[model samples]
Target chain A: GAGVSQSPRYKVAKRGQDVALRCDPISGHVSLFWYQQALGQGPEFLTYFQNEAQLDKSGLPSDRFFAERPEGSVSTLKIQRTQQEDSAVYLCASSESGRSYNEQFFGPGTRLTVL
Target chain B: GESVGLHLPTLSVQEGDNSIINCAYSNSASDYFIWYKQESGKGPQFIIDIRSNMDKRQGQRVTVLLNKTVKHLSLQIAATQPGDSAVYFCAERGKGAQKLVFGQGTRLTINP
Candidate 1:
């Protein structure tokens, strides 16, 4: 079975540029999640979706960070006007259900570098 | 604000020996806890998880122990192998919460 996968495994964006990171979760997964990880740090929750509905966006740092999972499958995390602070690895995870008990399978992640 | 933290930033253990990593969480309301192992350039991989109701859970060579009284969690890996070398994180989810609160992480090194 294919695990969660992210595209543009490595992205180098100039400051003030816009970047879009994509994630494809495991087939039939009902819950998807996004997280941001800084160097030598654990991943921080960014957003969550159950199907096509955006359930939680509380972890999003600012308005520049937006995510969409339209049609309930592929997800995109877009950062507008990327800043130096936006440089980090963006991780995507999926689980079989929305319940917290299920294990979350994670993608390799997109390493975004803001120059 | 809720936070999860590990006691040690790194640990080194000889191969075939048992290894233990500890984490402390501030949120007593957290009802679910999980451990993850992440290799360089890769996302976190789930290791084991324990609910608030149970104090311990085991999977293969890994064991997770939770102490609700002290808000502590520990992961024990028996007969540690080189493949076990990676950064380990402890994450907690509060009741009815969809997001996971993660700790800084502890790097484990398995020595030959």
Candidate 2:
């Protein structure tokens, strides 16, 4: 079975530029999550989706960070006007259900570098 | 705001030795806890989890113990192998919460 997969594993964006990170969760997964991890730090929650509906976005750091899972499968995390402070590894995870008890399978993550 | 934190930033252990990693959380409302292992350049991989109701849970070569009284959690790995070398994190999920709060990770180094 394929685990969660993310595209553009490495991204280098100029300051003020916009970037989009994509994630493809395993087939039939009903819950999807996004996280941001800084150097030598654990991943922090960013957003969560159950199917196509984004039920939680409270963890999003700012307005520049936006995520969408329109079709209930593929998800995209967009950072508008990327800043140096936004540089980090963006991770995607998925689970069989939206329940907190379900184990989340994670993708390798997209490493974003702001220059 | 409540947060989860580790007592140590790093731990070095020899192969075949048992290892214990500790974490402290500030939120008593958190009802679920999980441990994750992350290798370099990769996302976290789930290892084990325990609910607040149970004080302990055991997995293959791994044990997770929860102390609701002190808001503490610990992960014990028996006969640690080189593959076990990675950054470990403890995450907490409050009741009815959809997201998990992760603590600063503890890096485990294995000596062959």
Candidate 3:
């Protein structure tokens, strides 16, 4: 794909169910980011990955949220024991360089609904 | 107090009219600012970027103006068209990490 791609455009999970969201960044991109967006709010940074390293997880809200990028190309964000507040859109973005200033391309995002 | 838009600020202009969207950031050390457009059901797409060094930067049909003193930013779109209708967001990257703090956003509705 010419741009970033994500999986499970829509998901419905029970309050205690676990869900995993996938992100395939643009080929050769060195920076990958995950953000969580609530209804009518802008995306909030969750984590940042530089290649295969999880450089920043300071934005992760709780222990239930975890993300990994072992190969440096693709990443996964997992949420365990989801709660109603977990219902929001998860957005993935990638940049060519792992620098401080770079243009990021985003995916369609996954809309998660917790019941 | 948390920053949330009580009502989405809207800009309605006729086709071909130039449009300006404004944003106010709180962080003082922000050195990088970016403008993104997000359509319904889609994530934000990078439109243009501006560094704090210069006050103004221009792209194809867009111009970004940054004022560090007042912590204000604005995106100016030239020759607005129906296809340009979307929500615009301004983000600031603070010192250290590249995490962006986005604004409340303004809805641009190009009336044809």
Candidate 4:
């Protein structure tokens, strides 16, 4: 793809319902990341994957939030039993390498509204 | 929590004025830093980047300044236009997974 792409730009889920967001990274991107951005706040890291291996997920916020990047290409962030507090924009980014100095391209983001 | 531009610094400049936005990061081990421009209801667009070893780097219409001693970073935009009006953010990459930690951000409003 030309850039990191996300699906279903906006989502409205009921409490206790499950919602899934997808990400398709640029071709040959080795590192992928997910973040959550609350209203009037900066984006916070959620999880990281390097070529299909989940490395750092310490920032997932809770057990209900999970992300996976299988085959090092596409990724998915699934939230189980969504809560009202979970309403926010979920962002996905991809970088060419797993190095720190590399630039991570970001997607448009999925705005999840938990009602 | 540590904040970047908690009150949202405002920069109202003429269309051709050169705008400078500053940021202060806490970590010293952060080698990767980037400037992002986010418009309303859109994703962040990369502006420019600078490595830890370098103090300054320039792009098409943007420049980034890094001061390791004070952990400060600044972005200089040349010939600001109305389209440049947006919130700018500076992000630092983590140690292991290289996850990005973003600053609070500064809102730039270019006056016509």
**Clash pairs (backbone) in predicted model 3:** none
Candidates in order: C-alpha RMSD to true structure: 0.7, 0.7, 2.0, 1.8
List residue ranges in candidate 4 displaced over 4 A.
B1-8, B94-97
Residue pairs of candidate 2 with colliding backbone atoms? none
Ten-residue region with minimum lDDT total, candidate 4 chain B:
B1-10
DockQ scores for all predicted structures: 0.86, 0.86, 0.72, 0.69
* Backbone clash total, candidate 3: 0
Count clashing pairs, candidate 4.
0
Kindly report the docking quality category of candidate 4. Answer: medium
After TM-score superposition, what is the CA distance of residue A18 in candidate 4 from its true location, in Å? 0.7
Two-way DockQ contest, 1 vs 2, winner: 1
Question: Which run of 10 residues does model 1 chain A get worst, by summed lDDT?
Answer: A95-104
Off by over 4 Å in 2: none
lDDT of 3 by residue, A1-115 (tens): 5788899999999999999999999999999999998887788889999999998998899999999999889999999999999999999999988788888889999999999
RMSD of 1: 0.7
Write the residue-wise lDDT of candidate 4 on A1-115 in tens digits. Answer: 3999999899999999999999999899999999998986779889999999999898998999989887889999999999999999998999999877788899999999999
Q: Rank the candidates by DockQ, best first.
A: 1, 2, 3, 4
| Evaluation by lDDT, superior candidate among 2 and 4 | 2
Kept native contacts, fraction for each prediction? 0.82, 0.84, 0.64, 0.67
Candidate 1 residue lDDT tens string, A43-109? 9999999999999999999999999999999999999999999999999999999977888999999
TM-score to true structure, per model: 0.99, 0.98, 0.94, 0.94
Q: Regarding lDDT, does 3 or 4 come out ahead? A: 3
